[model samples]
Target: MKIKKILNNSAVVVKDRDGEKIVMGEGIGFQKRKNDPVNQAKIDKVFVMKDPSEHQKFEEILQLLPEEHIQVAEEIITYAEKEFGVMINEHIHVAFSDHLSFAIERLTNGISIKNALLDQIKILYVKEFEIGLWAKELIKEKLGVEIPEDEVGNIAMHMHTARMNAGNMQETIDITTTIQEITSIIENSLKINIVEDTMSYERLIIHLRFSVKSLLSNEKNHDYDEKMVNMIKENYKEAFACAQEVGHFFEEKYRIKYPEAELMYISMHIQRFYGRVIMS
Candidate 1:
């Protein structure tokens, strides 16, 4: 790989076998030149993107945010991508940088803003929230400032927005709030934690995500087997009862009634969750 362009003393645009990549490290670009062989051992991070537009936006982000903040954001971005097993939006290069920069500045000046949705974020996006907490550690390590824990939820929200490709922050908040409510009702009714980070928990999250979308869009699921619903209700009595409560909870809050079939499937999902937690 050869250095194609130098962004600063610590970062450079490099040409690799795959394509152009922006590599970053401590003093990696210092005294570097175009077409010079890049010392692979000195490289710390690589921003590789298949989308040319995203790449362009990334370059813009590098220029937009301070290199120090960008470095922290890069670590967080790498961790989030690996943890979530998804490609986060390139906008995060800008969104996350801006947020972190502001956060660091505010903390320096002893100004703190409490995240109103902190609790909801923890419950609804458990994985992201955990990553957010980890982010606080990195921020403190690199910046020498201890930001309040509430900042984790705000950080997680940005990462969640990047993953969801959400058009607006409010949408993530709205969906997160709805999912939190549904999950709360389930946990409260069933007296279980839902055991975050398990396959059953993943399934539960997926189901709740789609269920909220279905209800919000008024997408009526007309096809349902009455016998199947009855069978589930009889065999998985406890799970079915919890699912029924979930349905009723939604009805009371959203004025949306889940179909009997939807409740039955929810019961099946809950049953699978119980089986997993019990074995563990």
Candidate 2:
């Protein structure tokens, strides 16, 4: 392959028979100029950037990051793909690289950003959080940086987003934040403390996750029993009211009306948590 552009001493854009691809390896582009032939023996990875904007941004970010940093981040992404046994979205290449670069810079400067939704992330995305922890260890081993667990949560968020094919980082954050808010709404409305690690808490979390997904997808749950739903509203007035507050929260935040089927399910879950105490 002939070099088209040199991104850095370790990376170069090469024109192969297929197309223009980013080739990365240690010293791959050292002393290399445009039109220079890439040594196949030194090549470690090749990436085809399909999206024009994303491709441009990836090249820009790689220029700012060290070769070792890019290597370790790529390792983490590869690990995630193997662990999940699926090819993650290509967008993770740019997103994870940029996130890790910024995170390492801040941590090196002793500025740690706290992830408020870390606990929620741990509960809601168990597998992704595990991969995040693995990434933390790998980063320490390769880059000599000790990232905090909060940063690990952020990493997990990126992995989860990639796995779900939700390329927007802000949307993942929004969903997590909404889950936390919904949990608080239920606790405060029902005047009860939800015992963490309990089955009830887990069930509520799963339900809320599905509720958010349905709302986002504009999915209509048409299987609602009208009589049973009305009966739930009357018999479990407090629980239903709490669910209504959740609905209001969703409507205000997303401008999507929470469906009655979701309300019935949420109210039932709320009733389970009601009158429950921490089991010490």
Best by lDDT: 2
**In model 2, what is the error at residue 72, expressed in angstroms?**
1.0
lDDT to native, each model: 0.81, 0.87
Number of the top-ranking candidate, with TM-score as the measure: 2
lDDT string, candidate 1, 1-280, tens digits: 8998888878889887788998888888889889998888988878887678877767777766678888888889999999989878877876788789888888899999987666557666678888988998998898787878789998888888888445456778777677777777888877778666577766777777777877777897748889988899788998999888888888887787878888888899889877666677
Give the range where candidate 1 is weakest over 10 consecutive residues by summed lDDT.
164-173
Task: Name model 2 segments beyond 4 Å from true.
Answer: 278-280
TM-score of each: 0.63, 0.93
Clashing pairs in 2: none
Q: For residue 58, give model 1's deviation from the true position in Å.
A: 1.8
Q: Which stretches of candidate 1 lie over 4 Å from their true place?
A: 16-18, 85-90, 164-170, 177-210, 216-280
What are the RMSD figures for all models against the true structure? 7.1, 2.1
